[model samples]
Target chain A: MSDPMAFLLWVKGPMFNWALAIFALGTLARLLEIFLLGRRPNYAEPRGGEWGPGLRTVLTRSVADPGTFQRAPFDVLVGWIWHVGFLIALLLFIPHIELIQALIGLGWPGLPNPVVDAATAVTLVALVATLIHRLRHPVKRHLSTAEDYLIWTVTFLPLITGYLAYHRLIGPYPLALGLHILAAEIFLIVLPFTKLTHIFTAFIARWYNGAIFGRKGVQS
Target chain B: MSEPSIERGLQALRAEIDAPVAAFFSSCVHCGLCAQACPFYLETGDPKYTPVLKLEPLRRVWEREFTLWGRIKAGLGLSPKVTDALLAEWEELLYDSCTMCGRCSLVCPVGNDLQYMIRKAREGMVASGHAPEGLIGAAVRAVQTGSPMGLQWKTLEVQIRHVESSTGLTVPVDVPDVEYLVLLSSMEIINFPEYLEAIARIFDHAGVGWTLSTDCFEATNAGVQIGSKDIAATLVQRIVDAAVKLRVKNVISPECGHAYTAVRWEGPNLIGRPYPFHVYHIIEVLDALRAAGRLRTEGKETDRLSLHDPCNLARKSGVIQEQRNLMDLVAENFVDLEEHGRYQWCCGAGGGVSSNERADALRRAAFKRKKAQIEAVEPERMVTMCATCRTQLEEGLEEFNMDIPVVGLTEMLAEHLVEK
Candidate 1:
């Protein structure tokens, strides 16, 4: 419905280019980290049967136990909501769709408007709630380093900008969309550097854990 | 209930430890990723009992004393009150609930050592006379006497004689000029006598010159478990003194996990010098034997066997890989459970939590994750390297009504070893 050429120009302009450059540089830095630090494997060896069983247990226990949910209910609730919301927002954003469309020619149907809108709203609310929780909780506050706040800011900014762009509440739609894309690129670049790197490493950590316990005959 | 002298001693220790304990709490990021790795969290799903939440009391202290905001909060008397009830809750949270499994640290992106933090917190609790009565009493006895269980030298001599008769191997105690001095926990001599037989069989089988000490025989350092570094050092010092007297080249730690940490990591530091004799965990010794082709294992017929990595051996001490190497030699139907190495779950026994009756239900509940791992393999028996893990799993599995039998790797090795 918007002017396609105008949107492209804004996305390709100096502001977007600078953001893309920084984003690319940040991503490169993250990749370099793996090489620089070298791979430190978690000590446990892989148990052959562990992956399937461990996954089943993790899934079942995660749902069955309300105690874990109750212990830090607000924290867990916000954490899951933010994480799922952020992921959906990343995947279903129009620019991501365009990229996917360019690569695979739009074979799949796009996410429904209501789902995207809901995820976006939830992401914004969850992020703010998490930030507030971090500030107010004594343990969290004591533990919150400068880098932690920086990570939160970097993560939250793009989500906020993308929401604003989607709502056409910030300047023009094209400008907002371009800003959102730029913010996203920045996020991707920083993903590996910040605590966000846990995204890539969590499963690896989990699998490593499973394998070790499997070898030792302990439960993962 | 109040022993003023004990109370005074605790107050002094608490005063000494307050600052370092406070600093450790200030270091966590509170990401809650540690939840997924903790078996206790998996079992009860209690957030307050999660490894991170156990650190909250210390976190509050950190905020009050160290941080600007915390100081401001404290200045205004707006800080969360650390009531006697809160301290009591923490005693349950820190000791009863946590196994100090080190899984939380493995999953921690920041490399925050939650086990160490928990151990220190326990130590602080011990200092404040808030530790579980059983753990503190054991530590106190170990300090007063040599052994945590207070088995006299004569009882230790009788146990050694049983080992001598059963294995037909002479386990010379208090012998001078032994090249290697093997230190064992009282548990091996009392309950798990097979562990002694296994060690004696291995040492004799390897033709390695090693002897057990009559004076300082026990290796299970309850001080390490209860967070009494002084008592831990005192217990270890007896072994070190024996080693020095016997002129042993190596101090082979028995199959106890915490014993290895007490004697290996803290021993050198406590003694204020690197040990002249290198310390070797029994698994390491066995691995060396297998590696050198000095020992061979006859593969046993079994439906399936899983390995339970003890938290101290796997995570705290970095001896995870060696155990796997030994397992390969012993089990034909060995099926690995998930999260084996540094990431492995605890046996719900470490950090003296195994001795705490109040934590028993929580400990049993925490075994759900481990039980799920066992059920995955559909194994008949689960083997582990730690004696405590073996006991914990045996008790834990039974409490959960799992049919799996838990045994030590050494016991399994003794069963399957082919005489060279």
Candidate 2:
């Protein structure tokens, strides 16, 4: 256990279990707390129907509208690149696909190595661009708190370390791999508790806003 | 001296934290898209005026009070406290610079309702005695008198008499079993009595049965602007009780943006029951008449025209297309503003900014966004349905030295009513 390789094994086994437990239970608890708060039912006669706009907004809000796109195209463009690149880099790799298949009995052909390597490079660039943009823009800097910068760093560690391990760009290969797994574990552990909850809540918020505004007859 | 208490303010904020609010705070991605949508931020280049930034105090309160991590942070004295000075500093951000326009809410990638929180934050402002005196006085009058401007029934009666003499039409008062109970804003009663005359002439031509209730004629709720739900509920109760007493089939909210929001949207929620009758914005009623062939206009205005959408009406209430449909009947030369309807910018006065004299400079500053939109189209006249928006546009144009004259959509429709 004193060996670095042995430490990496511990992180992959016991540490993985701990991260998964916290991620699942914490997320469920936070979601329940929000739902239990319960809104006072509105008695106003609805000016428009709800379900149509409510469900529609959950999908529609994925892309910025023309007005919003005009105001900040760079943010939107970088944002989509990061999201798509991260999903491909994380989920479509051969080892990651095998891990999922082992756990959930789901498997698919992984993208070729060169393709994932390109996505890794693009994802890393988008993530760094986001950090620079956040720090440089006055309004973004004003709205940002310690939590925001911290989230950015935590979200960055797994990808950068993974890139380093895959390309053998720096450090010992196993050490980098072990650190990447640890960084991902930390992210999973913190996901349900922090602003990173946006992964789940953003959809619900859009639905609720759409429903309320929809009932008022606005296409939110 | 009766002063607002921190306890009251904190209590109001606590009361506002429901499921949606909690979710909104958690989901906010700090994307800064809302700042781009905010006219105040665009006009002043001030980050503090960002729509989401305006909710800092409220968000602080939510974090420290609601979230586990935030509560832990608070226990360690790590979180910023919502102190008296904090409330004072935020008063302008919450009230003066914001129009509760909902553009930020609409543009948010995560769907955080920044305007909703701003409105909730004002509850804290009012409770802590941090609200601007101009708005406080208006709310006080709205409570004591039937109208916010302290206009009496006699004032309306004189205008009604003048309208009668000029138009040769009776202004029905407290008529039983009328089809519509028309609620007027004091702004309309005081600044634009011609709106009443237009309604009288249009209703005569359209043959819509309606009356003005002396008991609840003023529809704009200062309590809504001031962000006190108790006071707002009282104002809504007056309208509800009057409608029940009058037994009218419907109530008409006229030529006022927030007035319609107050009565049509918030009214039932405030009063705790649906009204026996429905409510409609005057433009919606007119459009319905237009659809039914009950309205006929002699001719279209030859001058080029465009609409300035009031935030509460077009964006918040879904009264977008109805105004455009009505405009088509009387405006042959009408051109839509490039950013018209739901995406339209505010005239920067609807959410009680007009009543708060302190906000005059900031209000005018935000109006530049609308000014640019209107300038691009180069309209001969600006037509809007909301009285508060109309007032803001007229004042904003005058300050900018722009030669455009503004007219109410109802007045324009009245001008073209087919001669009976």
For all predicted structures, in order, the TM-scores are: 0.69, 0.98
Clashing pairs in 2: none
Model 1 ranges with Cα > 4 A deviation: A1-220, B1-29, B81-85, B271-273, B399-403
For each prediction in turn, the share of the native Cα contacts (below 8 Å between chains A and B) that it retains comes to 0.02, 0.79
Off by over 4 Å in 2: A105-110, B1-3
Q: Which docking class does model 2 fall in?
A: high
In lDDT terms, which candidate is top? Answer: 2
DockQ of 1: 0.06
- Tell me the interface RMSD of model 2, in angstroms: 0.9
Residue-by-residue lDDT tens digits, candidate 1, A13-129: 755666567656754554333333332222222223556644543333223134335446777678778888887877775666777687468735558767887998999999999
Candidate 1 lDDT over B208-287, as tens digits, reads 78887766777778877877666777887888888888888888888888888778766665556666678888888889
The true-versus-predicted C-alpha distance at residue A136 of model 2, in Å, is: 1.2
Error of 1 at B88 (Å): 2.5
**RMSD of every prediction:** 10.0, 1.5
Give lDDT per model, in order: 0.68, 0.89
Worst 10-residue stretch by lDDT in candidate 2 chain B?
B1-10
